[model samples]
Target: MIAHVLDIFFPPLCELCREVLREGHSLCGDCAANLKRIESPFCQKCGEPFDGQIESHFSCPNCSTIELAFDFARSPLQAAGPARELIHALKYRSRFYLADEFAPFFMELLEQDERLSDLPQNTLVVPVPLHWWRQQIRQGNQANEIAKSFCQSSGLPFLPALQRIRRTETQTRLTRKQRLSNLHNAFRIREKMREKLTGATVILIDDVFTTGSTAHECARLLKKKASVERVIVLTLLRG
Candidate 1:
């Protein structure tokens, strides 16, 4: 009754198109339909979509020369249009409810991946952590919220095993080399979570995968410090 009254005063509208929506939905059918899912012919190592026709699995040129700590990284949507807007709203505008809206997509993506669908007993979902200063400024971590939503829906264990020891500048304008250098020694394994990570298959969660410097650094810390068996980087969008 309260919800119905609230809906009457402030009707639910799609986040992207402002279309009227039924209760309990952040996006309307049209906006949801407009989302671009990443298709085949993508790099197997980094999940970067390819423009040309390639029948077999392959790695992108970026991944070819680089040594990544994670086994693979995958994202459901291309970071553009409505997908990018939604992420920006969630991360910068503090529209945190969008995390729940993204959870189902993450779950579906995980189910489709053979490597992720069948999890071992030692598997855990870990969000790429924000530094204490950032967390205080933001009041919450977007990655942590998305990871928690995913874990709640998928029945996976959520483990915040990594911490940002160094708060570096944003990577938006940085060159690939600058990104790599900026994130050097940026992460560390949480001491309390050290024992839980031994031989664990960690699903590292984040909002976006740009040059993958952040993911690689976090995965490296997990493997080197905690003896984690594998790291699979998962994000909502591929930038």
Candidate 2:
């Protein structure tokens, strides 16, 4: 009853188009349709979508040449079009409400991945942490917000087990090597959560996977420092 009254006073508007919506959806039909999902022929290791035809699962050249800390990474959407806009809004524009909208997509990805669908009892969802300064400035961590919502819906345990001990420069224009260097020693396992990491499978949640430096660094820390059994990187998009 309260929700109905509130809706009458303030009709929900599509986050992208600003169109008044009759339902509780964050995006209108057209805008939602514009978001592109990552289909097959993608790199099995990094989830980078391939343009050509490939029947069997394969790793991209990038993954083959390098060692990654995580077991595998996957994303349901391509980081373009409406998907990019929504991510920017949540991370940059402080539109925290969009996190709930992203939860369903995470659930979809989990359901589709056979490995992730049947998670072990020791599995936990951990969001990639932002540096203290960035967290203070942003007033929230977008990854954390999304992870919380996903945990609520999926009945998974949420563990903020990592902390950004160093504040690194933005990796927007950096080379892959440079990005990795910048993130070196940037993360550490939280003292209180160290016990939880022993032989655990961590589902590292993040908003985007660009060059994968961030995810790799975090996974390395979890595996090396805390003896985490496995790390599966899950992001909203594969940038």
Candidate 3:
């Protein structure tokens, strides 16, 4: 076949290292192994990594008194090293195909994490929306792309139920309090989309979880405005 011959002439290479892939793989095994994964002993509320032994359902001291809208948060990889490179490629460089590589890995993480096993069966996968102006500049929403790929692989439906109503300042240098204030009232569910969210569980998708200001605001809107029963946040990387 023409496709078979083309493969012989131009084999697929790793996205990061350009090493030849070993059949049906995008990233070479070595590069894949180099990705830093987020494991156990993390905060129950915010999913921050902890250094010492902690009992199940334990909240990190940082989040102990902080009230979050989502039931829990999780990420597959730490936001560093190869994971950071892949995120940057997908987010800033417009390497959209990298989403295909992230979808399965995220699913694997979801399955392995006991914290997520109890998610309501009526869950919907929703990506945090970008402001319309920001979306125009980016040419694409990486979070939606990742959510779409994840839904395709998992047979769960993807919902663009939430909209970013305000265009705020860049959150890069903002303190946690400032980030929260900046994102407050920044999200609203479309009127038509509101009905679909009633009594449904939500899995908010994003590329990274930093201070969680964005996720919190989105979840708050979904819960208070949409009457959603529960919200759980999931991202590719935890900062």
Clashes of each: 0, 0, 0
Quickly count the clashes in candidate 1: 0
After superposition, which runs of candidate 2 have C-alpha atoms over 4 Å from their true positions?
A: 1-3
lDDT of 2 by residue, 24-103 (tens): 56877777667788878889999999997899989999999999999999998999878998999999988888898888
lDDT, residue 79, candidate 2:
90
Tens-digit lDDT track of model 3 for 29-107: 7787788887778887888887777666688776776788888888888999889988998888888888888887778
TM-score-superior candidate, 1 or 3: 1
Rank the candidate models, highest lDDT first. Answer: 2, 1, 3
Candidate 2 least-lDDT 10 residues: 24-33
lDDT, candidate 1, at 81: 88
Q: For candidate 2, what is the TM-score?
A: 0.95
Answer with 2 or 3, whichever has the higher lDDT: 2
Candidate 2: the clashing residue pairs are none
TM-score of 3: 0.94
Model 1 steric clash pairs: none
**Clashes by residue pair, model 3:** none
